[model samples]
Target: MSEITPDLVRHLGVLARIQLSDEEVERLTGQLDAIVDNIAKVSEVATPEVAATSHPIPLSNVFRSDVPGDMLSLDEVLQNAPDAADGRFRVTAILGEEQ
Candidate 1:
């Protein structure tokens, strides 16, 4: 099994953009080592001969056929808007900076 050391933990923290203290890195190293061991065991069981299955139960596409439906007019659609301008709904500015 691969040993996860402080260096490995620190590298992982950098990759994840996480700020960890020296003590946290030591704790995470042990935790990650155990997780890697569990994953290695899983890989051992997954052989070339065995078929990969994502879900335990059988699944089929339950979507209905695409059919054109009646659409409300622009005026009708904009009728319920808290704020509307011309023929469309007016929304509050999201960008903090005002132009």
Candidate 2:
């Protein structure tokens, strides 16, 4: 198990430019020790054959078959638009100049 000591905690606090009190350093040393020990335990159980995953359960993409369907005509599609150009939607200039 990784050893987390008061000296290490103080050194980390200095490296991080954090002013940790003596009491805080003592408390964090124990907490960090426990954390490292637990991580070590988990490492022992994780074997080469065991696939590492971010989530506990398996996941897959649920997608529908790509098939074209009937679509509304240009006029019908733009009927509800707030503003439209010759045959497309028109809005305020976003980039100061049109592309």
Candidate 3:
């Protein structure tokens, strides 16, 4: 009941521009057949009534609640900075880009 044949494997090798050895082609044919059989088994287990989903269980957000709190003054923020320019933090130019 193997769906993949050595001839099909050889054809695929040619299409992919690969020079597979005779043993490799035989091995790939068997492996591909097993993969196809497994897929068929999986499809059989899946029912139309069962909705497709990304996860097995329901997921909830693991982040803190977004509650707006405090606003820091520009001078307060610039006080601890190594350098400040035009009311903003000054950083070194990177990747040949102008600062």
Best by TM-score: 3
lDDT of 3 by residue, 6-37 (tens): 99999999999999999999999999999999
Q: Which residue window of length 10 is worst by lDDT in model 3?
A: 90-99
Tens digit of lDDT per residue, candidate 2, span 1-99? 449989999999999999999999999999999999999989999999999899998888899889999989999999999999999998987885556
Which candidate model has the greater TM-score, 1 or 3?
A: 3
- lDDT per model vs. reference: 0.91, 0.93, 0.93
lDDT per residue for candidate 1 within 20-76, as digits (tens), equals 999999889899999999998899999999889999998999999999999999988
Relative to the true structure, candidate 3 reaches a TM of 0.76
Pairs clashing in candidate 3?
none
TM-score of each: 0.58, 0.74, 0.76
Worst 10 residues of 1 by lDDT: 90-99
- lDDT for position 94 in model 3: 70
